[model samples]
Target chain A: MMKNKKMIILLVITILSLTVLTACGEKKPTLNVYNWGDYIDKEVLKEFEEEFDVKVRYEDFGTNEDLYVKVKQGGSSYDVIFPSDYMIERMIKEDLLVKLDKYNIPNMDKIDDRFINLDYDPANEYSAPYMWGTVGIIYNKTMVDPLTKWADLWDEKYKDEIIMLKSQRDTLAVALKKLGYSMNTRDMGELEEAKAELIKQKPLVYSYLGDEIKGEIVGENAGVGVVWSGDAVTMIRQNPNLEYVIPEEGTNLWFDAMVIPKSAENKELAEKFINFMLRPEISAKNADYIGYSTPISAARELLPEDIKNSLVAYPTDDMIKNVEIFKDPTDIIAEYDRIWTDIMSEE
Target chain B: MKLKRAAYPYIVWMMVFILMPLLLIVYFAFTSGDSQSFLDFTFSLNNFKRFFTPTYLKVLTRSVNLALLSTIISLIVGYPLAYIISKEKSKRQNIMILMLVIPMWMNFLLRTYAWLTLLGRNGFINNILAKIGVSPLNLMYNNKAILLGMVYNFLPFMVLPIYSVLTKIEKNLIEAAEDLGANSITIFRKVIFPLSLPGVITGITMVFIPAVSTFVISDLLGGGKYSLIGNVIEQQFRVTGDWHFGSALSIVLMIFILITMAFTSKIDKEKEGGGGGLW
Candidate 1:
């Protein structure tokens, strides 16, 4: 009887080893998703892996331009990517993205109607809205007086204490909006006016910054910064004294959307991952992990009441009426380039 | 035959990595890159023409100007220090050189980032100043800060060459100058200075070229307040996706550095022909 039991155990071990060998011979199909660094929840990826039983290869890109270049250079194959509205428009124009099959993405209805049919991806043909946010003034109240407007950035008292966004569009948009002009205006005269305003404001600017503004503001290096909403929320948490104010002049409203690249080898799996991300629970978890406002209305409902009602994260409808989205300024970006170069090169 | 065969890998490396990229740059520099396709290009001078604008010219000149200023400062600061170190006992001289080189062991970016902490508005220096009831000075986000970062980063480049040359100069020459009734000043001006010319030139070349082409120091210390030529080229390739224009600016920057290099090589040849060597 003991020999018989031993023989049964040995037979089971042999079958298990054979199964492992075959599994190694033919691996699961993998889906590669490249996104902005630290832009997603860790647990959501694990959930996708378990639910789909497909291998997941995740990579992070520092910037949208870096992602575009990687795809253009054909160095690495990526199944899906997260790009902002302007970059999405550029990709669509360049034919770098594959059109989404709406049938596969059943959770697309979860995305708020307000977030859909935008200039960057009209009719939801190519991209699904992920996280949306606005750019605004993040200030340390102790160092700065109640900062309420873009003009407050150029206040003489804040000289050498202001940090402006480093990107040409973001900074130029601030100047344009301050002057009550449209942010996406290609008119050279308006751009020049904006340039002059920026030059005038330069002496007050301690540093032109990117994502590092959060650390700088929270650390009290600068009194005020023109920063993104999600980063502002993070900074406010780090330093309770710091407050975020979207200036009365208005700001840039941006959406980062997920879309599959045309070079993706596993389109079906990529669509599955996108649909997985849009599931209300997954989206809410992601929104809680990442401070950015969720685009899905269902996900927004799931957010903690304090964060969901926060004026900085979700501004009132009347307040955001004048806010503009960046259209892909393809033809005359060179002009903005020239203006920015001139502005930066000024002695 | 064995030695030649051993060099085969490096030759392949030079062809694949170095020469090919350079040739590709030249190819891109002359092409109209509206489409960004490698094959579908027209031979055009538009890239070069775009470079002649006053805006770009001013940026180029500013980069050169900043580099020249940093080189001059490094020479002034490094020469005396190198001389002092060379005049020390051999063991102490090695210690001094090592001390000069220790900071470089840390990454250049790390060293520059450290400067951000020390010179920032609310950084350590300002914290100290505030204790004494002194207003914090704006030590960053300007040309001066950029110059400081460049000098701090590249001073070793300047000092090592000068120190090497100074140490190599024969003590007998100094003794002979003194025996001829020449004072220390005369010995330094005529004998020591003239003999260190080769090292000075090498130091200048090393410091000036890197300073002129540096994007990181300016980006970090200058706080992206102003655009240098290096910044322009970086934006063209990385930010704007205009590799053709970037290649053109690179070619232009290359021409500037090449002129300095050629001029230095000519000086080196003259020094060698005129018996700049002592031993």
Candidate 2:
């Protein structure tokens, strides 16, 4: 009986190995692309796969930190990844990314000059801009006055009606901007003041939220909230009473960019994928579908007139003059970590 | 000896999957920096020291309090239901247990998310209240909401074990107690309750352990306004990239759980000893 059991196990193992071998024999060269959830049009991927005749293995990540951990752990070999500005800077510093071969990506010229050579990648050598947005207040116009300043979020009348971003940097930026301080301020005192102001505002906050912020505002459960401009645009479309504004004090202007990781085995195919995405038509489809600002100026022309004129998506230069792109906080991350812990842990 | 040989695969599985990860957690808990390699090591008590401050202690206390409250509430609700099920016919008992287990088969996160829609300010409950001319009650994003999530999710853990023990109970003991001129309440107190102590202890441990370490339910139902100990450890690992501190907090929690187990098992042993002499 024991020998028969062993024979059956051996048979099963042989069948498994045969299946694995057949799977490997029929495989095509694959390019692994990782990006934010629901950030791209699915049809663009199908088009790229058909045109290139290569298998496109697509994955989505919830946050920049999740992407960082996956890359840093060396568990997965992704050829292409999309990470936000601060994360891109951190990756470049850690030598986790390969410099982009700009000559191969001829479509780079179509990208607007304003987005090129940004603070995160000053030389524009390591990454290409994918989407850009600003952090701002999205409010229910019926429940709240037209908010022009970040301080308006702290009004007592909106007690248990205000929603704040659960993220560390974005929420802290609101307090910093309200105080007329730099959003990327590294000064310990400024940070402490921001922490204090947030704790004081904690009681009035309906909740600290991430993606759920949109649902709350759209449902009119929250009077106002700190929201990503792109998300605000989408929320306004869902509920007409919702309005988005870039607070007068300005906010964090952030960018998500495509970069080839150092671990990538298919650099050339990754570059091809990037170039295809940067094409005005593909970029416009993505921007229009996702409701985010596209960096390709040509893509902007192709966007419908209403979306093209959206102040939330494409803020005027005057509105963004006081804005700051987030810098990597490697120097005082411990302080930021402590301050966030303090805020969350406080009664 | 043959039975012991049959257990070899399981022992090896436990060592590789359970023992190794625990050893890694301990190793990470002692180290200070972001050193990924095993060779260059600097050991320190700073991670534990950092966790003992008033802010983190408050979070730890909150986690314990909430977990204890949920465990107690689960027991209060589960014990009676379990007792009733135990008294039912054998076929009905299986059906009732199967009904309880059905929700557990669904994803825990999806089940918790469903509660958000049911309890949100603009959710179904509030909508019904609005139609009835009552004001919308602030239901979601509060301590009570979090407690509801915990109890709802972990109630099965509390019930199943107790039900099993209650069913396995020897019928002769209750008959003997009744024959000794005991009323129903007196018979229950003298025989069945004492016999079910083991299951109650198991149920408490099962419920409390998971509830204390839960972060998702709090994040979803509590609205991230409240930070439990699990949330702090999750923050350190996921957001702040401070694995050393996260590992240290995990070690502390493991020790806390170990102590609770020791206390409960001692009670279990004493009861067994007291009952053994009579048996």
Candidate 3:
């Protein structure tokens, strides 16, 4: 009886210890970050982990819409997210972002005033700008005549040589701007006009591209194409023969901002990471690597002269004047989406 | 009671992971709001109304057509390759199939990016064409690119099932057909084809469902210029923040898939009866 009792006690202890060990193994600190693919300098992440001693888990989505879906679903616990200007506006309206404590982010003072107190976060309350760029035409200088305005996309001379952004909002907005309508216009008649214009240009377009637009333009496959300023800058660096032009009629200026989601489990750590990214040296390094215009004024000052002088990074004052920032259409978004689908199905 | 207790964990897992989410989607399909905190419980048909609009309907039809075309193309290309492989010696067959499947082991996004390098104007194919004095083809961001990407991504799915069934087919059956003086074409059509019908059906299902809902390939290769049912549904949820409409689209898509599956299974059952003990 004594021997049997001892054996039973040993078996119970072994099982208890095993259960405790497994439970401990399952607990660990993890920070989840959701951002655009290829938008980050991955080496910086490695350095951050070494310095902070925290496990950083990263996830990427292909589009702003994709990011919005995951966040809106309510169960996702992402610590940090990168969203564009209009998306930030929508998220603020929906109350999806956590208000930042300005004291915790002292480096916030280094950000360019132009990026602060904008339409998305008028008080600079919920988000911090990461990068800003304009939507413009990127062209191979040798093959195409100089592009001056959004109407150049429809010019018969460049028929089948022009590529446009595949995004309904971007493509339609350009047309609307060219037609002298507000980029955020909700008027059904104006939207219809834009739709008609897109259809007219449809036959002349070589293709509609997003990320691939830069590479295609650089390779001389397209004479002129609508492209994001960041990608345009990257392409022009690779091929000196290429030039980026902000259409004289008007173009969309977009800013990507970082925000801490309400569902974040590591809000404190997320704030720290955001502040670190704003450090002048770090911000300048990111701008140099990504080739996107930085929103940090101090960081801009620190960049090499050539980078600062790059026409793609800092367009002429006249060019900047011709650009209009995109605002959240809110109620009229559905109308735009509908018109877009109709146009896509026409062919 | 004892049996029920033993099965409790599995039941709970299924309910929590699968049933709960599906139920939530169905519920949200009729409700409105961005977040759960703001959800209004009033039932509305606005979501369904949006789906029935002519614009969305056109995209749905186009998606169905694309799926059908991809299914047929995959069948034609994959079945023969599978058949040929199945006839080879066992060791060589294993090696060949492994080679075919190796590409799938890489990340899907990486493979899609590889196609960008291959199809771009300065890409390999275009460079070779340019060297030969032919004009560079605009094949990277259009319907042709979309179709090529879909077929490339899904061909393995088609090949695997048909190959499995073909390999299991008894060699004596084909020999028996030849003994009865049936020619090669007649033997294949009457014997091999019927025996492999189950795999062909399975492959069709595997290819069609994914092709219809494929958003990434279309976005990446087609340059997001085209609208498919998947893209429309995705935009509703993500871009417009219209969960109700997105859920409605999802439910409609699910219904369409079920109807197609039912029709396929009915045909499969009929075929099963006509084909003899060739299982």
Candidate 4:
């Protein structure tokens, strides 16, 4: 009986090794794209895969910081990544992204001139604009007065009826902007002042959220929230009484962009994917599905007139002038993180 | 000869799955770089030094305190429930245990998110409180929320071990104590409690270790407002891009847990007169 058991064990080991070798040998020309969750349409992905005959593996992250960490760790090789404006700048400084060869991407001409020469990736050398929007107040008109500024988040009337993003950059930017300081202020005193103001506003705040804030706001559980314009558009569609406003004191203007990582092995496939996404019809579909503004001029023409004219989707030129794009604070990140944590820990 | 062949598969499985990954964590903990090449490994102490910072130390202590609190609370709540279940008829005992563990079959994150919906400012609890003209409590994004979440998640760990031990106790011992004119309280203290000591120790260790390392519940329930040690270690790998520091924090946490386990074992040995043995 014992001899029979030994023979069975040997047979099992042989079978397992064969399976492992077979799995490792089957490799295909593939592209791995990492982006935010609920930001892509499945039909578009299926179409891209069918047309190119290349396997597309997609992953998601809740925040840009989460994406940055995974790319930095070098755990998985990603052909493409979508990072926000400041994060792209940081990755560039760290020499983590590969420069795009514009020769291969004919659709680069479809993007508007406004998005091409942004400070994050000057001259459109390393990254392509994927989506762009402003941070703003999303509120239910029936539950509260119109909120027009960051300070309105601290109003006692809306106590426990407000939600804010939990990100250090966005929350701190709002506090800094409300205190009349630069959003990227590196001065220690100004940051401390901003931290104090945020602490004071904490009592009236409900909770910090990201994508989940939209459902809460739409359910009428939250009266106002600091949310992205894309999420606000989704919430407004669900509850027409919802209104979005770019705070009077100004807010951060952020953009998400696609870039190839320096460690990417399939550069050709990555470029092909970027060019595919930039096609006007494809870009318009993405914009309609994600409910975010498109930077492609051709796509904008295809949008419905009401969506094209919506101020929340496309802010007035004057409002755009007041907004500032975020810059990468290379060495000052640790200080900002420390202040944010300390503020959160306080009573 | 037959035994040697039979042991080969088990040995190979252990070496491949368990021992290999442990060896890798140790290797990477010492090695430094964004690349996989280990050419410039100089055996540095910098990674370990980062854990000595006051900020990280405070988070570590807070994690230990919260874990201890959760373990103690779960033990208090779970012990009576386990005893009651064990006392039930054998057929009912299985059903009761199944009912207790049914919630655990769902994904942990989903359950935590469900709690968020039930406890948020506009959640069910607050809505009901508001209807009665009472002010809603700030319960979702605070220490209270973290504690409630920890206890709810880990209570089963405390229950199963104690219940298993309690059910195995012979009924004749308790009957003999009652026949000898001993009161119910005295019999329970002497006969029942000592026999269940091993389960209590196992339950405490099981609940405490996971609670200390738990990051997601605290992050979601605590509103990312409070920084626990788990969050600090996560930030090192995620935000700071400092793998060396993260490995050091992990080593420190490992050392702390080892010391705790050692101390608990020593106490248990003394209580058992050093010869009864844990096994």
Candidate 5:
């Protein structure tokens, strides 16, 4: 009888302690922020949490498509998301994003005017610019000749020595650009032409790859690879023998931006976090760590002289002659997917 | 009553993890992708119709072909190893089994990724070849490489089951077969092999199912030249955002595997009946 009374007393103490701990946890509102994997500095997030006295729940996604599917399916609520050009457009079309209040994000002026009012978020109401880059060839100078044109990728001399992108849009865009067609073309005939071109080039190609393309090139397993400009910068740093080129036939100029999801519960806190990230020092820190170019002009100035002057990080306008930003391929996306499947399914 | 209550947690787990997802897959497979609201779904056969075309059939055929080739190779290689291990002393058998399982302790993706270094142009093999004044050979980015990966990963799954069954055979039965004037080969064929049929069935299922559904191994080793059904299904959900078509493909693959399991079990039952008659 004495043991049973002691047990009841112990259980009561445990229950009271648990409730107190949970009550402590509930004191601070959590802001869930989802972004691309390895894309942040992490220190900035910690700094924001300390500054605002709000808990930040951070998660990462592998691809833009993954981000889109996760948000669209709607199990978890994310206050802030970082999506790229075409993806931002798609989310706006689906009414998945909340319009940003300029009053909350006063640091919006830090972003360059050139990066503002872009096609993805035309009025700059939905998204804040984060980082931007171009898609081009990164090649070993010792293995291949100077690659000036996208048509050079088709030359038989580089047989089993070229690494193409595994991504459907990126790979298809390469073929489309080589054929002197727009990357965002809605015409079925143009898309079919690109598909045929890829099929023809498949024999000469070494493999279709994603992040592994960097390792393959640096290890000298492949002579040439099609990669984003940011990855090119990092690869060049790893192996000085590598050279980056935006092909004369033109390529994709892409942007990644921050937006609030419509399901966000902590809208005000999310804005505070975005404004914190837009600070010159914080943006510069992220740019330095991530090896991606920042859209903030002030952040660019604060970067080290070598990084600031690096042509690959910030290409001159004339250098990218016919570069195009990817738009939401809403109408032609299904056709594009079918063509991609066909290209990948070819025996 | 205690045992029944103990199973309640597992029942709840199954309902959430297995049964719910299965029902959801069936629902999504039959529904069109056009619906905006969560509750309202337009039931349609379009997803299934899309999968029945010549292009998708080719992908399915490729996945089955690769999986079958890997399974056959595994059985041919695994059976002898299993038999040899089963014949060993108990302590030594345990050691050998531990050796087999130790490689599996490492992550599967890491193990597969390590093959790239061993098989690449400037890799360990080619580095050795270069010292001998022989040119580097092309070993990566091919179908043969993909088969090697599947066999390497799934070989243990094929071997362990057969070994356990072989070890469990009654010693007296083998002794009696020998006393009755049966040779070693004759004894194995007439007695041991028949009894081990259940293990062999399990081994095949364990290896074949995973090999058929594997996407990572094919993506890494096959060099993205062609799409397996696994890759196609993954593309639909992740890349193309067509969960309806992805669900349909998954349903079809599941049915194909179920048919395979049924056929294997029938063979096992037939063997059991014949072996009982022999006894």
Candidate 6:
């Protein structure tokens, strides 16, 4: 009986230990990260996962709007997101983001001073800059005449050969800049004027496009196209026949930033990840990989000479000195949206 | 009791997924755009008022026109194909149905994206045209391209329902008509076409509703220039952060779809009651 009792106890003990071990061996905590498509280097995610001993779940959204809707839908709990300036402003106003604890992110000093404390997040809270670039006209060298201003888009010579940005704010901003007004003009009259201008210019535009603008430029489908500087960088490198110019008329100098949402389950992990990304080597690698300008000042040295010195990548200080960034339009956004929808619907 | 318990989870799922969302939309439709507070339900007709703008009405009209066009095209293309398939042997019929369904296995979005590359200015078709010493056709970023996409994607919807109804049709009726000295055209017009009325209605309802509310096709092929009701609703909810307006537009769209469905179903009933003899 004693021997039998011992065997029973031993069996129970072994089973209990096995259950405990199996439970402990289950999946690691996953860090849910949402970012723009093709915005990150693949190896960098792997590196972060290995360094942190946690699984990384990365997802992509096509636009700031997509990112907002997905986050609002509550279908998934995302820890970190990368949204552009105006979107960050909207998120901040909506109270969708948490006030980031800067103490946890000590590498903040590495960011270029010029990128710090801008219009979107003036106090340097809630967001950390990831990449900085401008919205400008990228032109085919041999096909188009000399271009210097946003008004050049309306030139008759480039009629049906000019591609415009499909975006609401970016396209509207072009007309607003040409009119020598703020891109974030809340004036109803000024907005009406701007809308009229876009409508008048619609015939000259070949097609209002998004990413396909690059392919169109490279294929010589369009003589000139409105594009982001980072895209221009990549396109310029691919074909030497392309040249990017920040229009003489002031344009948008936008910055995209990393932020932690209030719904993040792993807030500490998110901060750690942001700090990890802020490390000089990682920032440089990301900038080099994405063809976007590094926000970190120290990372410039780590970049290849060509990328660091590329005119498209690094614009002269005068170009961006008085440029505007998008603000959270709030109720005024409806007007802006109305203009875009109306413009598209016009026959 | 066992069956009821088994069904409990499904009921809960329905309530959570379907009924709850509908309720939320109804609630949002009537409320103000400032949804920052739980008690901020300050109700208004502003969303409805805003929707009636000339611009929005134009978009609505365009959506209806395109949806109607695509439905007609699908009927013209799909009805013949379904009839031919129904005439096949059962073994061959099954294979033909499978072949029709196989293309849908990839994805609707992927298929639409494929059209983007094929119809683009420097795309394959344009390349071929260039090689043939013809100027490349300006095909992309237009209504024609969107119509093509809508017809291609929704043709399966048009075919499947008609095919199912046709296959169910008894052959003896057709044979009797033929034995009575009715030719193929007379037999088809008198017997087959009348019976297929319900299937035709179902197919139209399926294809028209989806085509009307199609955002992706318009965005991809229409080159972001053509703004339909779907794109507007999407922009309102996603881009503009205006749920009140989005939900209101959705309700309006829902009403339009519902009216169409009711009209189609009424016609279906009349046909059935009339024994499908109307020309």
**Candidate 3 - CAPRI tier?**
medium
Distance from true position, residue B135, model 6, in Å? 0.8
Ranking by TM-score: 2, 5, 1, 6, 4, 3
lDDT of 5 by residue, B1-279 (tens): 356887999989999999999999999999985534646778899988988888788789989999999999999999999999999999999999999999999999999998999999899999999999999998898889899999999999999888888888889999999999999999999999988877788889889999999999989987777678899889888888888888999999999999999998899888772331211
Instruction: Flag regions of model 3 displaced more than 4 Å.
Output: A1-62, A66-82, A97-115, A258-279, A295-297, B1-13, B170-181, B273-279
Q: Native contacts retained by model 6, as a fraction?
A: 0.67
Native-vs-model 5 lDDT? 0.90
RMSD of 2: 2.5
TM for every model, in the order presented, reads: 0.92, 0.96, 0.85, 0.88, 0.94, 0.90
- Compared with the true structure, all predictions reach lDDT values of 0.88, 0.90, 0.85, 0.84, 0.90, 0.88
Counting only residues 3 or more apart in sequence or on different chains, how many pairs clash (N, Cα, C under 3 Å) in candidate 2? 0
| Candidate 4 residue A253 C-alpha distance from true site, Å | 1.4
Collision count of model 1: 0
Alpha-carbon lDDT of model 3: 0.85
B1-279, model 4: which lDDT tens digit per residue? Answer: 356787989989999998896676566677665532457665766565645666566788889999999999999999999999999998999999999999999999999999988997779899999999989777787788999999999999999888888887889999999999999999989988887776777778888988998888888898776677787778666665556666777778888888888887776665572222223
Tell me the tens digit of each residue's lDDT in model 1 across A1-347: 99999999999999999999999658978889899998898788988988888788899987677788888788688998999999999999999999999999999998888988999988779999889999999888898788899998889999888999888888999999999999989788999999999999988889887776777788898899998898887778789999998899998999999999889988999999999999998998898888888888788799999788888888889878879998887677667778889888887
Q: What residue pairs clash in candidate 3, if any at all?
A: none
Itemize residue pairs with steric clashes in candidate 2. none
Candidate 2 chain B least-lDDT 10 residues: B270-279
The per-residue C-alpha lDDT of model 5 at residue B171 equals: 95
Query: What's the CA error at residue A235 for candidate 4, in Å?
Result: 1.5
Which ranges of candidate 2 are over 4 A from the true structure? A1-16, A19-22, B1-3, B273-279
lDDT of 1 at B36: 59
Pairs with steric clashes in candidate 5: none
Error of 4 at A149 (Å): 1.4
Worst 10-residue stretch by lDDT in candidate 4 chain A?
Answer: A338-347
Of all true interface contacts, what fraction is found in model 4? 0.37
Superposed by TM-score, candidate 6 places the C-alpha of residue B176 at a distance from the truth, in angstroms, of 2.6
